[model samples]
Target: MKINFKNYIASIFITVLMVSIFSSCTETKEEVTLLFVGSFTDKKTGEGIHVYEFDTETGKSTLKHTIDSITNTSFQRLSPNGEYLYSVVDSQKKYNGKVAAFKVDVPNKKIDLLNIQDCGGLNPAHLAIDSSGNYLVNSNYSDGSLSLFKINNDGSLSENSQVLQFKDSSIIKSRQRASHMHSANFSPDNNYVFAHDLGADKIRGFELVKKQGKVSLENPKEIKTKPGSGPRHFAFHPNGRFGYLVNELSGKIDAYTYSNGNLGFIEDYLTYQQKQHIYRTADIHISPDGKFLYASNRGPEEDTIVIFSVDENSGKLQLVGHQSTYGEHPRNFGIDPSGNFLLVANMYTNTIVVFKRDIVSGKLTKLPFDISVKNPSSIQMKTY
Candidate 1:
């Protein structure tokens, strides 16, 4: 065979060029992180859900798309795999709330609604999907119920299979006179689900039992919070050894040591410095590294996010610092997957503020640019 050395050399060069191009493309895709914000919708200035492209390098976010038809999307979450999105229609009317699922396409900036289902209770405030993405737990605020739904293969939600209603009340007459479940969170192991009840002042736990393809919550346990603490949101440390609950009415955070399916109380810390007539501590989240915990406190007095350094070995917290949200009503906030930024959804101010986070100090500094979205209610971020 006659060898063509020139042709062979050219072919090798082309092969190397193709390999470099493919590697670049893959890195670009992996670097993308999307910010999904759910907002309260009204007839006039309604933006139901907005998605943004978060630039990890610059710490800036640009609005990518908006879905305006879904009304009152107060809370939204992405599936464990980042292939689906779920949001809640936070209704005030009785039995009129819903949970909707969508197929998320980040590169194309599209979110197609898969299906909507009745929440089986009033005012679906929060929803969380299990690690397997096979089960969804929705907490209804007005009626104080937790509804369980199974996720279909295509990411749509099945009708709620079970609804657990709570009729207990707490010491506060006006706020705790009736049951008001605020949020539902899954355990780090996905073997249990916990619901925070604001009105009843209790953290309710249920063993998640999955048989074949169906799922149910069994072995319900009620752990009483402070009499008037009004537990609203719960977050577990990444180590799975500790958990924290933000008390809405009393402006306190309860720390607990978690083991198996039980929570042993550690202590409680005040979320704010001064006492006030009303305290609306809203959201709680731990850093990806589990070194710090951030909790939001809404205004009647001050709008701030309190930062605490975690004692990794002891599962205790030391107050690190506080950052003003730079807007009113810091209802919910999210820390990026890289732990480099924190975004706050100030519902009353109708803006989303991005803050550069100091991983060492667990402090937040306001970024120069912020997003304007009407009634921004919830903040969720996913890396795709």
Candidate 2:
């Protein structure tokens, strides 16, 4: 064969170029972030859990998958390792609520149902998983109770290991006719479990104990909120020294000093600008960096997210500003893992709005794009 040096060189260069191009394509395909939206399923509107691909660099999202048949998944929590997901099926009937477990397939944006077990109470609204991933805790809203379930190795949930019911009620007649347990969460140390009762106006703490390889709750303690403050959701600072509780009816955030499973009142801060306006507070979350805090408000005329700056030493909050959600009934909102974006679910308007977060100032600027979903009540994000 005749030697052709020029053709041989050209062939080598083309091969190298093709290899580089293929490598770049693979890198781009693996960089996607996943977002999960939990919603109330309606026959006319969309139902089940909706999944989306979020672009952290561009601040945009696209719907990827929908897991249907599960109704009223108003809240969900991703396991610490991101391999599993747990959700509460909010039901109105007594003892009809359920807690379900799902195996997460992050790369494919899919979730497989592992198993579901009865929540042992009514209107289960919130769920929390311990740091060890060995237990799942549920808050029963209407029945004013909390249930703890053991998590199996296969991502399934076992029957209730312990159930605690509250019977005390506060002075508010209509709203406090019975105790309404709204949220249950494990303390940052995992040494204690906290449950917030809206109708009782109390934030209760229980010691987490292990006996013979089984976990249980003991040493119950209660902290009273302001008389009319319906304490609903709770958030602990990243530092674990300070805690925040959002009052559902009073539109206030109560600051507390948390230590050794005990919560001491620090101060009460209003989430809205005007005291006269009717305000219904929904959720509270601390930024991953612990420099800022955000709370959601819902009312006929007030649909806003209140932003506050944290005083590191004192753990007190300073009013930063408020951003209107632009949609009705801002039920819940969350700060992304990177602490770069904030997402709000407006249930009444059926929309999820994204905002660019100012990490330094703790202010939010609404993004140009928003997602339309059917009654999107909760939003959770996990990056794989």
Q: Evaluated with lDDT, which candidate comes out highest?
A: 1
Q: Supply the TM-score for candidate 1.
A: 0.93
Candidate 2 structure quality by residue, lDDT tens digits, 1-384: 897999999999999999999988877545557888988875222366988989998779988888777778888988888789888875554446888898988777878889889898988889989988989899999989999999999889999999888897887788988999999789999999999999999888899999998989998988889888998999989898999999998899999888888888899999987874556899999999999999999976788999999997899999998999989999888788899999999999999999999998999999987999988888888778
Q: Candidate 2's C-alpha lDDT?
A: 0.88
The whole-model C-alpha lDDT of candidate 1 against the native structure comes to 0.90
Q: Positional deviation of 40 in candidate 1, in angstroms?
A: 0.7
What is candidate 1's lDDT per residue for 167-270, written digit by digit as tens? 98989998999999999889988899999999999999999997897779999999998789999999999899899999999999999999888999999998
Off by over 4 Å in 1: 1-30, 43-45
Clash statistics: count for each candidate:
0, 0
